[model samples]
Structures are given as structure tokens and as C-alpha cells.
Target: MSKPALLVTAADLAPQALALLQDFEIVYAGKTPQPADIVALARRHDPVAIIVRYGQVNAEAMDAAPSLKVISKHGSGIDTIDKVAAAARGIEVKAAVGANAAAVAEQAMALLLACAKSVVKLNDRMHHGHWDKATHKSVELAGRTVGVVGLGAIGRRFARIAAAMEMRVIGFDPFAKDLPDHVRPVDLATLWSEADVISLHCPLTEENRNLLNAQTLSQCKRGVIVVNTGRGGLIDEAALLAALESGQVGMAGLDAFAQEPTPANHPFFGHPQLVLSPHIGGVTSDAYVNMGIAAANNVLAVVGKAVAA
Candidate 1:
């Protein structure tokens, strides 16, 4: 007898993860999959489960797969999946929460350091045979304060690292129960006003979308450094641009953007103080395997099965 099909919304999965799903026939959706492409593939495959790695799974795609039982996210964020639609259809939606936390937190740490030290700018000057060792003075991190938004796994990990640097770490997360001793919890207003460096580690929710806008930016201390390894929607790009130009935000290191694979004409491109990456914070090799295993487990559990030992 033929096995039921399982779909992965990426070109590939970890070999270890795939080995555990031997009971099903796995199908792949190419990278950079569009909504229409996902819908078409779902309709044609009628997969029992889907592991979303790199695409948005909307109501249309869910409806296309009649036999779908679970929509499993490859990483922590489930904003790309339509949870309400899945619930209405009696389909389970699961996220591999915290599987990539350490990897992302490491990236955040690097960005914060880069922003504080003007690492990229200095490197550029050196390449052009310019020496500004006497003129350039970078911000010292020790004893400085950093307000971390969202004290989840990733946020907590970052807090630990910041604390190691002898910096004060204050965080804001109403739902976080396991507060570390080093990370003091504070309100949003307090975080904005007091933090020398502000790092965003929150998810994109209707309530927190554009949480860092012109109004909030104005509340922050002058020349506050900003680091975002979280969702792009958490910031209003226009407001940030103005802040950058006005010297309100001294520097910003952003991994995620409002638009993925940002267009060539994006205004953030040419800004020296704004360091941008292609959102590969969680793309480390270790995180890749961990997230894949977690996602596979989520799919199997929702389907009334257990991953092979």
C-alpha cells in the first residue's frame, strides 16, 4: 500500500529529519515559493501534513489540501501560517518553538557589537588606506543599559550574553514567567527612555506591529543604538529612516525587513549607520538540524504518530 504524502515548503530537509518520516512520501516546494505556487502544490499533493520552512501558508493553501491534518512551522514564528483558518478547518497548527533560539541570539549579539563599535565603517576605511584610529571613538558597552523586548528563549539568551559584557539588561515581556535574575523586567515606556541600546526579540503581532514608530523613537535617548533580530513589522521603516537622519538613532542593525529579499531601491541600503543582513540569523547549520527535527516531531505528533528513535 502507498504511504500518505507529506510536504515540506523548502527544497530540502535535514537527512536525519527525513529519515524519521519514512512512513510518508515527502514532497518539496522550491525555495521562494509564492502563495499561488503553494496552493497549486497543496491541491495536487493533498498532503496529510506540511512543514513550512520558507513560505506563507494561507487559507487558500490549507483549503487545497483536503486531507491535511497539521501545518507545522519549521521555526518559532507562526505569523506566516493562518492559525484561525486552520482551527476552523479542524487542522492543527504547530511551531518548533525555541529550536533556533540560540542561533538567532548569537546573531543578535554580533549585530549589537557591530553597531556599538562601528565595525563595518572602520573596516571600510582600512580597505581604502584611511586610518582614523585617533579620531574614531566607539561607545563602551560596560555598565551601559540594554532594554530587550520580549524575554522569550531568544531574548533570554541575548540577555545572558549582554550581562556577561558587564552591561545592565532590562527586558519587557508580560507573558514570560521564567525571568532570569540578571534581566530585570520593565515597562515599554521605561525601556524606551532608559536604554542606551534597544534590541527587539518579539514576534509580529497585531498589537506590537510597528511598535517602534516615530512617537516611540522620540521617547528614546538621543543616539540610542537599535538591534533587531526579530520581525521587521516591529518597526516602522520610515520612522527609523527619519530617526537615523536626525541622529536620534545612532545606529541600527537589522536582520529582518518588512519585505524579504529587500528590493534594490530600499532606502536602508545606502545608510552607513544601518547594517543590514539577508535575515539569516537562524540559518546556522546547528539550528537548521534542530529546527528540522523539531518540525518533524511536531508533524508526527499531530498526525497521531511518534518520530522514530
Candidate 2:
């Protein structure tokens, strides 16, 4: 009997994950995991399981692989996968939840501190042989309020870090109860109005797409700093741009964008008050290994269960 096929959508999996999947006949897809490429790979390999890192696993891909028993996400977000389609086909879907939580939370904190201290702008100015320290004002985190949009693993870690800095930490998560003592729970309205800094840690959903829009920005404190390490669709970019121009928002640190590999002429590019990083909040070496291992384990678990049945 032939070994089961295991397809890897991206080529960057850690060696540990590759070693663990040695029992299966591995099929390496494209370096960049596009939806069409994934579909083509599925059709060619007829994989029993797929480890998805950065592609849209849509109905076409699912339909192409008749042998597919499990779809595993390398990270927590599953927005790119068509869960509805997978469920209809009786395929189990799993995510490596909390695998990169610490790494992402650290990145969020790094962004927040960078925004608060005007780190990027200062570094650029110094490199250019210009010093204009008097013009840019940095705020101290102590005594300020930080509003965390979610209370998941990442959010909780961020809240704890902020609290350690002596910043009052408040959070809004309808689904999360029993928050840490240092992190206060508040309504969205209160969080918007009172927070000096707002860090988004929520997952992207249809209902919360563009959660921070013109209307929501207007409700925030003047000169409030916004940090987003979550999905880019959570903020309306146009609204954020307008708010930055009008000084409604003081500064923004963005790790994710509405569009990946944002166009060269994107309006946010070179914005004085904005700090941008390619969506790499969870791409650290440690996170890569952890997420890869977790994703592989998910596939093994699901496949083992199927075999037993």
C-alpha cells in the first residue's frame, strides 16, 4: 500500500515538522502559497492532509483532493480557509492555536513602544544627519490606559505587559470572561472613549471587518495611538488615513495590511506618524518551529482518528 500523501502549501516549514511527517509521502507546493497554486497542488497530489501556511484553501482546492481528510492551519487564523466547504465535505479543520501567541504579543508590545517613543522617525532623522527632537513629543506609558480589543492568548499577554509598565489595561471581549486582575473589562464604547492607546488583538470576522472606521475613530480620544497586530481588515485604511491627517489619531503601528504586499504607492507609505511592518508579528524562529510542530500534530491526530474509525 502506498503511504498517505501530505501536502505542504508553503516551503518554509521547520525541519522538525518535516521530520514528523516522514511517515507520509510529502508533496511540496509552490514557495508562495496562492489559492490557484494550492488548488493545482491538491489536484496533483491527492493529499490525505494539507498543512496550510499562507493560502486560500477554498472549495476548489477541497474538491480537487478526494483523499483529503484534514486541513491544518499553521497559525490561529483560519479566515483564508473555507471552513464551510471543508465541513460539507466531512473534512476536519484544525489550527495551531497559541503556538505563536508569545511571539505575536511581543511584537505588539514592540510596536506599541515604537509608536509611543517615535522610534522609527527618530532613527530616520538621526541617520539623515538631522536632529529635530524638539518637534516630536514622546509619551510615557505610565498612568495611561491601553485598550486591548481581544482577551485571547496574545491579548492577555499584551495586557500583562502593559500592566507591568504601570499602564492601566482595559479590554473588550464579549466572549471572554475571568480576565486577569490587572486587566479591567470594559464596554467597547468606554474603551474607545477612555483609552490613550488601543491595541487590536481580535480575529477578523464579517461582523468586525472594519471595526475601526470613521465613526469609531471619531469616538476615540484625540491623539490616540493605534496598534494593530491582528488581521488588517479589522481597520478601514481610508478612515485611518483621514484620522491621521486630521490628528484624530496620533500614530499607528501596523503589522498587517488589508492587502498583503501592499502596493508601492500605498497612501500609508512614508506617512510620518505611521510605522509599518510586513505581517511578521508571528514569524519569529521560535514561533515558526512551534507553529509548525503544532500544525503537524493536528494533522497526525486527525489522520490517526480517521484510520481508527
Candidate 3:
């Protein structure tokens, strides 16, 4: 009898995770596969499980895979996968939650520090032989208030880091019941009004889409620094740009954007106050390995395979 087929929709998987699926016939799709490619592959392979990393698993793709029982996300975010559609088809959708929490939290702090110290801006100016030190003033993180939007694994870790730096840490998460000792629980309004630095760590949902828009931005303290390692849809780009221009928002550290692979002519490109990175906050080697293992386990568990301890 032929082995069960498994589809991998990423460029590669960890060696340890791949070894566990040796009993299955693996079909590898290149990273960032198009929607049509995914559907076609599903139809061709008749896979029982599909592991998605940086691609979409929409209704069309799910419908094509008649045998698919499980869809596993390589990381915590499931925005790329259509969970509602999968649920309708009776397909189990799972994520590797907390597999990359530490890595992501570290990245959030790195961005916060970069913005507070004007690291990128100064480095660029110095490279161009511009020695204007007096104009470039950096804020001290110690004694400042940091408001964390989410108190999940990543958010709590970031809060701990902030507290270690002697900064006051506050958090806003409606679902979170137990918060760290260092992080004071506060409402969204209090966060906006009192926080000198605001860091977003929540998943993007309909209710929180464009959470940092004109009205919310207006409520924030003047010259506040913002850091977002979470979803791009959490902030309104146009509104943020306007705030940055008017000096209401002193600086922004963005790892995710409203659009993936942000367009070349996007307004944020030349802004000196913005420090940007491609959405790689949780792409560290350690995180990749952990996520891969967790994703593979989820797939195996859903398929009734006895996952080795």
C-alpha cells in the first residue's frame, strides 16, 4: 500500500521534523507559493495533511484536498490560513503557539531600542559623513512607561524585559487573566494616555483592525514611540504616517506592514523617523526549529499517528 501523502507549503522544514514524516510521501511546495499552485498541488497529491508557513490555505485550496484532515501553521499567526473555511470543511487547523515567543519578544525590544536611540538614523548619517550630533537626541528607556497591547507569551516576555530595564510596564489584554508581577493591567485608554512607548503584540482580528487609527492616535501622548511586531492590520498606515509627519508620534519601529513585501513606492521608505524590518521578528533559527517540530506534531496528532515523545 502507498504511504499517506503530506504536503509542505514552505521552502524547507527542519531536519528533525522531516525525519518524523518519513513514513509519509512528502510533496514540497516552494515558499510563497501562489494560490493556484497550492490548489493544483493539493489536487495532484491528494494529501492527508498540509503544513503551511508563508502561504494562504484558502477555501479553494481546502476544497481541492479531499483527503486533507489537518492544516498546521508553522508559527503562532493563523491570519494567512482561513480558519473559518477550514472549520466549515471539518478540517482541524492548529498553530505552533509560543514556539517562537522568546525570539519575537527579543525582536520587539530590539525595535524599541532602535527607535529610542535613533540607531539606524545615526548610523546612516555617520556613513554619509554628516556629524550633526546635537540634532539627534535619544530618549532613555529607564523610568519610562511601556504599554504592551497583548499579554500573551510574547507580550509577557517583552514586559519582563522592559521591567528589567527599570521601565514601568503596563498591559492591555481583555482575555488575559493572569499577568506578570511587573506588568500592571490597564485598559486601552490608560495605556494610550500614560505610556511613553507603546508596543503591539496582539493578533489581528476584525474588532482590532486599524486599532491605532486617527482617534486612538489622537489619544496618545505627544511624541510617543510606537513598536509593532504583531500584525500589520493593527495600525492604519496613512494615519501613522500623518502622525509621524506632525511629530505627534516621535518614531515608529515596524516589522510588519499592511501589505506583505511592501511596495517600492510606499510612503514609509524615506522616512527618517521610521525603523523598518521585513516581517522576520520570529524567524530566528531556534524558533524555526521549534515551530517546525510543533507543526509536524500537530499534523501527526490530528491524523491519529502516535507522536513520539
Candidate 4:
């Protein structure tokens, strides 16, 4: 049998992850492929399948590759890919879900802890020998109420950690099925009204974008801390900024943003009450390897074995 052809458009996979594709006739590109270029490459190569991450796949990209049978994603979020277009042409779509769940969950906790204790502020103060500890008051997590705004793998894991810390944990997930004994299922309104801290862990769907706006922020308890480890569009930065400025929100820890490589003057750049990260929730070495291998294995399963549902 001839070697199968595969196109890997997402180039951030680690070296170990790249080495796993030794069996395929792989064509790699670091950025989103241009329509004309992808068309010519697909026509010339006649690839069996293509794997992409964080790239748009519209009707044009799909129609150009008649030989393409499957489209595998390196990450859990498939919102970037046009699934409707792919299905209209009979191309199977698969994603490596739950692969980076643990990494994201842990990072959320890291952010929450950092915010609760004012970790960054104190460290910066101490480094300058200003000893501003007199004015800084660190909050404790022990008896606070924490609300998780999604019950997927990442959200559930984060809830478990919060429960272990003796915090009152409540969750809101429309699709929630199996929840632990400690986590009580509640409506979004209840979660917001009661939680001392609220963490967002939902996808960037049309209905969910800007879920945390002025109206929703008004429902929360005063001096609430906010954390976002999932998609950035779920929260409105403008509303968050206003709340932060007015002291309605005590602090925020954000690992993702509306735009990556967030501009230097972005509202969050020097916000004293905010801990901003450059979408590094899943950037750990272990997460890189796991997601990479999972993405590569998904390709093999779909193109070589017709596996992966």
C-alpha cells in the first residue's frame, strides 16, 4: 500500500508530537493556508485527510479537496472549523476532546489562587523592597462560594479542586449529566448571585459570547473575583473593565483573551486587580505532548483505520 498523504496546518505541536507522524506523507504549514495555495496543494497531492488547528475551513477549502475523507483537529474546540460545510460534502470531522482538560483545569486553579492571595502584587512589591504588605490584604479560599459556569471535563475538575479546598462549589451546565456529590447543580442566575468567585469554562458559541456583561456582572455578589480559562469571547472586556474600575469585581484572572498577543494598550495590560496570561492554560509541556500525540493518533485512526467517532 502507498503511504497516506496528510496535511498538518497547525505547527505548534512539540517535537515528540511531530515525530509520531513518521508513517504519513505529511505536508506541513505554520499558518492558515491560502485558498489558492491549499487548492493547488490538495489537487497535486490528493491527500487522504487533513488535520488543522485554529484555521477556517469553509466550502471553498473543502470543495477543493475531493480526495479528503476526514478533518482532524488538534484541539478540543471545533468552533473554528465549519462543521456544517464539511458534513454537506461527506467529510468526517474529529477532534481531540478532553486531551487538554487537566491542563486547563490546573491552570484555572493556579489563576484563582494567584488572585485570591494577591500573589503577583505582593511579589512585585517585595521585589522593590517597598513592603506594601500593610495595605494589601490576602483573601482565603476556605469558606468562599465558587461557581463553575460549565460542567465539561475542565469545569468538573476545577470544581473538584475547589471542593477539596473546602469552598462551597456550585455548577451551571445545561448539558450536565453526572456531577459529584459535593457539587450542586444550579441555574446560571443562582450561581452568579451566590458565588463569591465565578469561573467561566464554556465554549465560544453564538449564544454564549459576552455572557459576562454589565447586566450579568450586576447580579453577582459585591467584590467577586472572576476567572476565565476557556474561550475569551464568553466575557465582555469592556464590562469587565468597568466593573473592575468601580470595584464591583474585586479581581480577575484571565488565561485567554478576545485577541491573542493582546495589544500593549489593551484594557487588561496594567490593571492592578487583574492577573493576565497570554492564553497559556494549555501551554504546559505535558499538555503539549498529550495533545500532539492525541492529534496525530486521531489522524491515523481516521485516515488509516476509519476509527474515531
TM-score of every model? Answer: 0.98, 0.96, 0.96, 0.90
Model 1: how far residue 12 lies from native, Å: 0.7
For 1-309, candidate 2 gives per-residue lDDT tens digits of 677788888876899998778778888786777888888989988999999888689999999999999999999888888999999999999999899999999999999899999899889889999888678678999999999999998899989999999999999999998888999899999999999999999989999999999999999999999999999999999999999999999999999899987999899998998999999999999999999999999998989665434
Q: What is the lDDT of candidate 1?
A: 0.93
**Candidate 3: lDDT of 273?**
90
Alpha-carbon runs more than 4 Å astray in model 2: 133-135, 305-309
What is the TM-score (0 to 1) of candidate 4?
A: 0.90
Q: Which ten residues in a row have the lowest lDDT in candidate 4?
A: 300-309
User: In model 3, where is the ten-residue run with the lowest total lDDT?
Assistant: 300-309
lDDT: the better of candidates 3 and 4: 3
Please give the lDDT score at residue 32 for candidate 4.
53
Highest-scoring model, TM-score: 1
Prediction 1 TM-score vs. true: 0.98
Q: How far does residue 289 in candidate 4 sit from its true spot (Å)?
A: 1.5
Candidate 4 wrong stretches, greater than 4 Å = 12-20, 31-46, 306-309
Candidate 3 residue 235 C-alpha distance from true site, Å: 0.8
Report the error of model 4 at residue 119, Å: 1.0
lDDT tens digits, residue span 1-309, model 3: 688888889779999888778777888889778878899999998899998887788999999989999999888888888889999999999999899999999999999999999899888889999997777678999999999999988999999999999999999999998787899999999999999999999998989999999999999999999999999999999999999999999999999999988999999998999999999999999998999999988998888453232
lDDT of predicted model 4 = 0.83
Candidate 4 lDDT by residue in tens digits, 72-113: 877777766678898988888887777788899999999999
lDDT of each: 0.93, 0.92, 0.91, 0.83
